[model samples]
Target chain A: MLFDKFKPMAEFQAELAARDVVPFGAVTEEIISATEGVVSGRRVILAGTNNYLGLSFDARCISAAQEAAGKWGTGTTGSRLANGSFEEHQALERELAAFYGVGHAISFTTGYAATMGMTATLAGPGEVILLDADSHASIYAGVQLSGAEIIRFRHSDPEDLAKRLRRLGDRAENTLIIVEGIYSMLGDVAPLREIAAVKREYGGCLLVDEAHSMGVLGDHGRGAAEAAGVEQDVDFIAGTFSKSLGATGGYCVSQHPELETIRYCIRSYIFTASSSPSVVASTRRALQILQEEPGLRQRLWENATRLYEGLQGLGLPVGPSPSPVVAVVLEDRSQAINCWNALMSAGIYVNLVVPPASPSTNFLLRNSVSAAHSTAQIDTMIAAYAGLLEDGLIRAR
Target chain B: MTQYQQYLEFMLSALEARAGAGVTLSETTRLVADIGLSSLEVMEFVEKIEDHFDISIPLNILPDINTLGDLARKLQEVDS
Candidate 1:
């Protein structure tokens, strides 16, 4: 009876196994490049990975990581509070603060820890948190643990956020508003300008999670806030090095002096071991590369546009706007699974998302483009999708 | 009718529309088990309730709520 709750999931896994469709956690046998990998015994174009800038396999980054590993060993054996605060960690923090033009920055072992810790610690009991309904699970977990009054406005609807704030009235000043720069599922972006304007009117601190948008957006790669020219309105920014920096870590940067004090109070930061020296070194190198090479961002955008246009030309239902992430929407679960399997068979790998993981009840075949994808590679993916349409596996929207 | 009764009446009507008119609703009726509302549908229903009552229901309270009576009681607490 203790395991009764897992029965449904077990049945679902069994069904998927019977169908020979392993959508989730398909192992990568060998990483050929930033944009190519041998997955499930087949060499496939890696489209589902969130490696936006494609710096994972850069020789410079690899060299930095190797050098750090040789100098500092493989891992930090203690938490930051204990003995894990290597000079590299502090240096990376300072660099992150400088990059964001913020007064303070704190790094975490994982993006989930950063977002969750910030969300949980920012507001407390009796205070309110107005978050987008489509927030990531990390944020939701943080809010549930925070003991704060968690109110979810409709996803990306500034009007709904305004309405909720209006109801709060005097309590609005104590509220924390949270939104992501680029939503993960559909690859849709938040209207940061409008949301920031609403925050200005409501008098609440705004936190923007730039996990997917950092190093992909803005002239300086400061994410949606910089792109929207509303950086001043944003109070805190949480992001991950895993996506763009091609490393494993997360950080929160803020102009507020209190952030330094708040760092001591975050259990996620205090209890967990800090990032290893190699990860920090590689992340620092990646950040430098991101700043020095603006052409990478341009190429990323161009690849995104090519994929978006190619999918649109095929009449596939894609996201609202063209970003590095392009997801094709489907209503039927079986059809979505078949299409995902078909793409995998065709040497193209993408993410198969079904509800309630998806933003809505619909299924999504999510593709993430990278700067490393050559024009020919992009066309190959498009051709494969076109084949799916011709086979009637997926219908044109 | 008291405000709580009015709220219950509205909820009953809404459930009847979704779960069929023949089904019965009471304070003990479980929203998910009895009415078969999916997670999304529950949120939509909560939004509808918030709009009708002109109140913002904190999602933090949902885990503690299961039966219709629990929701009505929680609504009353927040409404006040």
Candidate 2:
């Protein structure tokens, strides 16, 4: 039966219960403040959220969202191809294109939808899509839905990619190379310069997913493509507002004026309902803040470095380089779950990433730093890791 | 060196280029454990081997091949 197909979820939930740990998607009691939240009736420091710029609680964003809600009401309730194309939505798209210094932009309900619409429309049967082996699952799903021949190259290896393209011969012209600005799991920056160079050598298009890198990299916060000085070389750039902008939506920007045509053809964009008025408004405000205020980026980096170095001082296996995200790698599932529980008990909230979803075979405690975090809050998170280390709940790498 | 030996040397050098110059590899080396290669890196190594010989290594054979020696034997079978 249809219900029988979900038996594995039941078994997984039972296993998590047997381990006496909080299951995934545990509801918070309340958001105490911007940087703190109440989970299971305890005040916990929010270190797991994707509020990178920490604008979710910004006064200007809230005011804009409220004003838009009052002016446009709650939801659009229709697709952009139909009646859902509000004035604010078009305005956001224009603003986004200008912000990224691109020729065209199209916004979507979610980041997943942005990539889904792109891949499902970009390539058809017989065409090839070459992507990083460790690309996000959304990219995989997008390719699967597109019915394109999916080929994976070595992660961040340009020479390997060149070899694969050389094998493809003339089929290389139809290839689309996809890579992320910063991998979500490892928080490591991509070698965009080398990848762009390879794309130039081989006849192919390049798409950079900057979902995690936007508002965190570059002087203008245009993401890793801009930071690597290969912005003009990239053909497509997909990003999300949920992480840095503190809103729920995604967008694809390109220097090609033909990109606007996707709005009419892509099923995900044409059939699905557009983003709400408040989300669009708030996202626009946050985009302004992301550009106007460089101090937030500086504070975010400072906090990230402190947290990363602090975890290293405690002998933990943190991610390679310091970014807004600082992930601690664990050996096994039991160890990961145990540390997650220990951190929870100490009033620290972090993401528990397991196999399959994790980039590698290891479990991870994904910690994201926010610009809103104070020195005291950052200190508390570091001390929690130190305590876990002292208690032997976790070990050095 | 023989053709197979040259292929092995090429594979070792490719792995070392990413893993580091200090790394050492032999025919019996485990791709994941001994050399510290991620799943992506392993797939890339397989792709390089496939392109080198122009033979597609079926995914069904991946699970059985643990060491570089096993991979060499499998490639030999496919080559023949």
Candidate 3:
């Protein structure tokens, strides 16, 4: 009787199925997948997963993980403030600092938790949070929870941000400006140089979420800030290990030693259990491999360009700009579902983003190419989209 | 100008902008009837007001803002 109020799940599933956007998850995207269960009957050219650097399957990373598990016994059993701080965890923190050329770094359990902890520490009730309108949800929630007055600027428009800050006048000094490296849904990057300039002029701290661009951008893959050459300009650089590092955790790295003071105040860091030693070990190893190898990053960019231009050539209304993520825009919700189902039917699985997820704009098929993906896989993906375009499933002006 | 009259002008304009482009609105224009504030549209209007004035409009102020005059008067009072 207590469980009888679960009516929404059925309606949701029914509505989604009727529209045809069934969000399915799978294991991996090798020419031949190693796991069964999900992709058993699917041909899966796997383009939705955020494994940009393709280090999850790296032999060195797997070996490091196995060794760490043997040494640390699988779990940390406490928070970093308590008994969770292992020698490996401290080493990973140091490695992360050196990797980013910053003096301090603290790792969290997930990307969302990193943002939540970092933001909650930056602004208080009297302070203001000026965010880009299209920032990630974690950032939005973090500001909301911190009791900050969130003033959002137009997406990627620094002029709008300047106008908003001017409205705040003297109160702007207490403001924190937040932006992202590469937006997840549409796959567009922020105009960081202009944003950093404005934040500095306003005497505010800037936080850049490098979640989607780590291990994929920059000459050293130090994330998008490095790619933009504005590392020193930003106050807090928040990033996730889950996407490119092939682990589930987040880190807030900065040169400010006082940034470490947030360790005591951030609820997400204080409460959550520290990431497993195996995770840290793997990320460290992944970083080493990322630095040691440059060709992998090149292949990733090559694939991204191929898919993006291919979609454009097919005239399928790809996203406005070029990045690793290529989105096929279909404005109608049902059309997005149909296109998603069409991809799944072709044995190609990608993310089908709809209204709310797509910045209150249109529906889209969001895809990400990996460094591990070969030309053959890219060609197959392009050919499938070419078919869709020829059939007029995705229309263009 | 008197706060009442200033409030009247603001409401008339806000109602015209929010409800429709060419609607003739007066001081006593009911947000629910004349302007027709669906829950979503009401919140969007509240956002515009907050953004314009650079103030935090408490969520509680929403239910009481039933008319154009009421909204403008509330803004004046909050500003003061």
Candidates sorted on lDDT, descending: 1, 2, 3
Best of the candidates, DockQ: 1
Tens-digit per-residue lDDT, A115-181, candidate 3: 9778767898878888887888888778878777666677899987888788778988998999999
Whose lDDT is higher: candidate 1's or candidate 3's? 1
DockQ for every model, please.
Answer: 0.91, 0.09, 0.19
Clashing pairs in 2: none
Badly placed stretches (over 4 Å) of model 3 are: A1-10, A18-21, A24-40, B1-80
TM-score of each: 0.98, 0.86, 0.87
> What level of docking quality does candidate 2 show?
incorrect
Q: Which has the higher lDDT value, candidate number 2 or candidate number 3?
A: 2
TM-score of chain B of each: 0.90, 0.80, 0.72
**DockQ score of candidate 2?**
0.09
Estimate, for each residue in A251-292, the C-alpha lDDT of model 1 and write its tens digit.
Answer: 999999999999998999999989989999999999999999
TM-score of candidate 2 against the unseen true structure: 0.86
lDDT of 2 by residue, A37-78 (tens): 988667899999989999988889999999999999999999
